[model samples]
Target: MPRLWDETVDAHRRAVRAATVEATAELVHEHGLRAVTMSQIAKRAGIGRATLYKYFSDMNSILVAWHEQQVTVHLEQLVSIKDGPGEAGARLCEVVTRYAEITRSSRSPHAFDFPDLHGHEHAVAAQRRLRELLGELIAEAAQSGAVRDDVAPAELAEYCRHALAAAFELPSDDAVHRLVAVVLAGLSASDARS
Candidate 1:
């Protein structure tokens, strides 16, 4: 086969896989995990059962694939905000707020808390990357005297992540924002001294 033909085929396969993942998520979200079926996923994904099976043998596999992709996208978003043009303090704040919001949005018991999705290599890698990004931002802010220098950036990074995980059960966006503010404040120089 020609190089162009191979490239086109690869792209088509990726598109089909993406469609299957998205369709499965939508169905699971609407009908709950136990209520969704492979046939429904195939129809919603605009593919035959065989085609869907070719991409994913089961719904759990589809969920894992979707979650891995989501982790990749979320990591990329955090990386962009960390590297975006802003003062260190401002960028750190944005990253913290975004991370909190992501935690809240991804809190679906239908998928996120599934046993199959836990302890996956990609998720572990994404988490490490997130912590690294957060640490970098905190260190930068510390250099600028916007954040506390007393605490190690790595420790502060862990603190921020653990603290923001509460957003998972928060009832409203306003509450999430308040939590973000408190997290950010805890990193401030004055708050650190208190």
Candidate 2:
């Protein structure tokens, strides 16, 4: 095929695949996950069932793809924040707060619904990157005496992760903010010295 023709074909395929993923998520949200089907997704996506199958093997695959996309988007958003201008401690707090909000607003209300998905390579990689980013920010903050120097940066990163995980179950944004503040307090070098 000609180069232009190939590019067009690839673009069209991406559009179809994106539409299918979006439609599957919408259907799963409207109906329950178990109640959604390939046919419904195909119809809603305005693509043939065969085309939908070409992109995904089954409903589970479609949901996984949708989840992976969400994870990627969330990671990208976090990366942007890490790159933005701010003091190390302020940036770390912003990243933690945003991550908490993301967790609270994630599509799957129940984390156990897709246990296997959490172990997927992309998800694992994204999580590792997040930890590393947090560690770097923690180290910078420690140097500036914004956070405690007693704990290793990596350990503090894990501590922050565990503390922020509570946001997933918190009742309100106020609670999440409070949780962030508490986590920051635990990391505060000034408070520890006082």
Candidate 3:
């Protein structure tokens, strides 16, 4: 039953990692990055410091993993939106709007713009995939005469990504929505009436 034991051990490790990441997110939300420590996370996760170290070597590593998990969830949300109903332009607008709202409302630790947040090679690759997906969606919309033809698809995608980040700085969803509406308006085809 060596294989069964190994599987059990793997399952336990996964559970611990999930718990640690979740605890870190909660602490980060309540206290911000500076106030969160490994000891705090261990206590929050209801584990000893030694057990915490066994799962995550340090706070920075835990933060990186947490950030990755958040990005993965965001990407999945974007993909699901793209997969949903309506034309590409409408779908894209909905996706961007949803992104702005979520970022503005959530207590995620996106304030620091940490390089380790999305700078790791694997994280960067995931980000690239997200950009690519956005670009394709924008290009399709542009071809449909929905979005401005002058703006390059990649450029539009980059702007939207930056806008999503900026939206997080807003104090309220209404303010973020107004800003997003302006961006969406600018993306409209020239022939379309305001």
Candidate 4:
């Protein structure tokens, strides 16, 4: 194929795949994971059953792909926050707060229905990258006396992750924000010194 034709084909494939994943997520959200069928997913995605199978082996695969895409998007959003203009501490706070909001807002039925899905290697890798990114930010903030120097950056990063995990179950936006504030306060060098 010509370069332009190849590009067009690639774009089409991505669109189809994205549509299929999104449809699967919607179905799972509405009907629960075990209740959703591949036929329903194909219908909701506006694709033929054969076409859906060409892109994914089964509903579980579709859900995994959808979850991977969500994780990628969340990581990209954090990367954007990390690169955006701000002091290191402020950027870290923004990233954590945004992360908390994403966690709270993006809960799906499949999360409870298929807890094993989280053990996927890609998900684990994404989580590791999130920790590393936060650790780097903490190290930078520590140099500027914004975060505590007493703890290793890696350990502090773990603390932040554990603290923010509560956002997934928090009752309201106010509660999530309060959790973030508490996490940040614990990280603050000023609080440590005083």
* Full-model lDDT for every candidate: 0.89, 0.85, 0.81, 0.89
Please, what are the lDDT tens digits per residue for candidate 4 over residues 1-194? 59999999999999999999888878877888889899999999999999999999976788788889988999999989988898998999999999899888766545777756668999999989999999999999999889999899999999998888889888899999999999999999987777
What is the C-alpha lDDT profile of model 1 across 40-130, one tens digit per residue?
9889989899988887888778878888999899888989999999899999999999999999987767644465554888888888898
| 1-194: candidate 3 lDDT, tens digit per residue | 99999999999888889999999888877887787889999899988999999888887788778777877887888889988888988998888887787677654454663444556865797769878988888898999888987879999889887777888678877888898888787677874444
**Where in model 2 is the C-alpha error above 4 Å?**
1-6, 107-116, 192-194
| 99-156: candidate 2 lDDT, tens digit per residue | 9888777635544565477788888988899899889888998998788998899999
Q: Number of the top candidate by TM-score?
A: 1
Please provide the root mean square deviation of candidate 2 (C-alpha atoms, Å): 2.1
Candidate 4, residue 37: how far the Cα is off, in Å = 1.3
Residue pairs of candidate 1 with colliding backbone atoms: none
lDDT of model number 2? 0.85
In Å, residue 23's CA in model 4 sits off its true spot by 1.7
Give the range where candidate 4 is weakest over 10 consecutive residues by summed lDDT.
Answer: 106-115
What TM-score would candidate 4 get against the native? 0.88
Tell me how many clashing residue pairs each candidate has: 0, 0, 0, 0
Full candidate order by TM-score, most accurate first: 1, 2, 4, 3
Which ranges of candidate 3 are over 4 A from the true structure? 1-6, 30-35, 103-118, 191-194
